[model samples]
Target: MPSETPYARLTPDLVLDAITACGLWPDGRLLALNSYENRVWQVGLEEARPVIAKFYRPGRWSDAAILEEHAFALELAAAELPVVAPMVFAERTLLHHDGFRYALSPRHGGRAPSLESADQLEWLGRLIARMHSVGARAAFAHRGNVDRDTLIAQPVRSVLASSLFPSSLHDRYRHVVGRIDRLVAARLEAVGPVRRLRLHGDCHPGNVLWTDAGPHFVDLDDARMGPAVQDLWMLAHDERAMEALLEGYASMRDFDHAELALIPALRAMRQVHYAGWIAARWHDPAFPAAFPFAAEPRWWEQHIIDLHEQADELE
Candidate 1:
């Protein structure tokens, strides 16, 4: 049973021990956070406020890639941005305990950001622009990119390899995914070359924590090199909201109106990638519990239909 998942050895005791290893005392309270790619928790402390302990998924990211993420966060924080940078221990941000790589951060609380308010959307856009300005200054030598391999090819491979994919529909799945791969690639090619920079990578509303002062970004774990639009598309819900966001963004950095053309292509890519992510992670106990529908044949059927529809939109 221990062989079932990579996180099998990450017990609560191990989590607390990891905190202790970093010279902090945990108060025996552990709350598992909402994360599927990696194991995260809110661990209490006896002498200080609660800290977030995130155990990295084995082999998902190399040590250098993880350090680059931490360095980016620290760089943003040093610029007086509200991003939560990881706490350093023994002069290192990335640390190890019992063969697991984990990091700690101070907990910040906030509710879902209200995108309905144009002012708020503009505010978020301004912050994103500022983040992008810093992101543009450097390149991530060890990180991945938001490209065909990550969003399309690799995910399609996962879905095709997944046991949960309906065996009867294997041929059909391949046809749809392959077509999507081609369409997405062609669309990206048509868009010409867009400026790629370090981005929050997954900047949906959830990653943002709002306070009385304003918003502070959390979870730079997905940070990587990509176009600036990758950070903006998720925060804006509609044309009006996007306009307001761009208004603020324009005040800070130049916007590639052409990058807007990539939105549909990017969306199609995400649709393909999301299914692959779920299928690839199905072995993780949390994924099954969180995505029970993925276990059913109907889900696969619907997924194929969705992919077909995505292709239509792309065309």
Candidate 2:
């Protein structure tokens, strides 16, 4: 059954027609990739290699913001960093068809990088350092900063406004996030004015693909301006792992150790932001299907407990 959501009009026929309009003939093979924020597909071509088509979620980002993301990926690729840059079509990267905006990229395949290996961690660090070197050369004009307002305050409001959050836990949720907000603010203040640069905002293991050649970064959808540690902290699991990454990072560029203190705060912000993200997307059928646990009362209770734990970590 076709979803009655905003994407109901995005049928497979529309997908094929959109690609055909882009000057590529579809082979009628489409595999829906693992994505919820936006619809992505592994589309086969008539006589050419398969390409990935990413359809942007409506009302999520303005055209200028999306273009900025493309430019950053291109900039990183131009600097010889292993990032998947959008495939240009007819002198442009962003394309429009059927009231939707999308981008095409050549399909590259690899498995998730092994984070347990010190060597791999160091290698990833160097890659990130190089990316930051390019990222620092310019600032985003359209994309907002990854600060308290976007990561904490706005998300809290979304949760409060949404019905997905259990009514019984409302006061507890508000109190927990309120304390976390203050803690995050104090932590940022203590860190002082740190150098902000373009970052792979959602740098997690899933975004990294490891092959014989090394790691290749995919998806600049979450790219934004923030502290360099925002890109590095998620990749590190512990002190030793962090040391390995920083060791390689220091070799390529200067790193401020002070950003280390911001990790726990950042982690807390992510927790709050994640729940908000789910709540914001509850209207989308894919969200409920994939995150059924979010609907359960026990899950909300556990979420509250997790927030308390994060608060303790912040102190």
Candidate 3:
């Protein structure tokens, strides 16, 4: 068996073999996709077009949790929303081969959605509202929520434990993060208890692919239970953009104006969580290669400044 850091063992040959084991004929053409947490490949089929194979990051998510994400994507697809769901094989979406768990999905291609366009933003808003409508129907049994514990507290713990975090900056990092933590907590308390529902948890524009047919959502790996605004804030860049999104969202479902207040708090949490994410994954070669800037002391200095800025925003 491979160690926890198994990507070293997941060579091109192993990836193709995994596909062949799943009854698909690989044509020996494999393109590594843009993914860090999981190893994703664009593999050409024997006689058919290409498909995407996503190998789950070992120890990152349990089987039940991965299935919960798959089920949620399937649910969104069932509603006719343009979401890329895992392709089931032999009555199962989660398949195992060579000590790794993976799933296959048809390759859906499109450029990034134009967040600058009001019309496009509105369209995305409606889609998100519809997704939230279905998302509100039920809760995930094995999946977790997007909250302080998952995004902030846990990440703080991870960074502190990680050797990647510079010992020289330890006190500075702790002080800034501690202030941001208190500020975030106070902001959340000020917002009070807002509605929580299943969300696309990481709804950045990069996840949305825009084609003539419209936007298709990809990568539900970060999906979790959170406020509906968690999905919307990432899409809106300014007040006008947000207004357009809410306009479209209001057309489908009632928009809770109160959720807007949670955006800054969410942003702060994401900032903290992102640093932690890089720290936790620094052991993985991909992380350091992709985020070379994170290794510099100046980066940590700037990060401290950013955290302080976020604290000011919260205040």
TM-score of each: 0.97, 0.98, 0.98
Clashing pairs in 3: none
- Tell me the TM-score of model 1: 0.97
Q: Against the unseen true structure, what C-alpha lDDT does each candidate score? A: 0.90, 0.92, 0.91
Model 3 agreement with the true structure over 259-311: per-residue lDDT tens digits: 89888989999999999999888888788889999888889889999999998
Given candidate 3, what's the lDDT at residue 285? 78
The candidate scoring highest on lDDT is 2
Off by over 4 Å in 1: 1-3
lDDT of 3 at 293: 93
Q: Please provide, for model 2 over 7-121, each residue's C-alpha lDDT reduced to its tens digit, 9 standing for 90 to 100.
A: 8788999999999998899999999999999999999998899999999998889999999999999989999999999999878999999899999999999999888999999
lDDT of 1 at 127: 88
Can you write out model 1's per-residue Cα lDDT over 210-260, one digit (the tens) per residue? 899899999988888899899989888899999999999998889999998
Q: Residue 174 error for model 2, in Å?
A: 0.9
Q: Which is better, 2 or 3, measured by lDDT?
A: 2
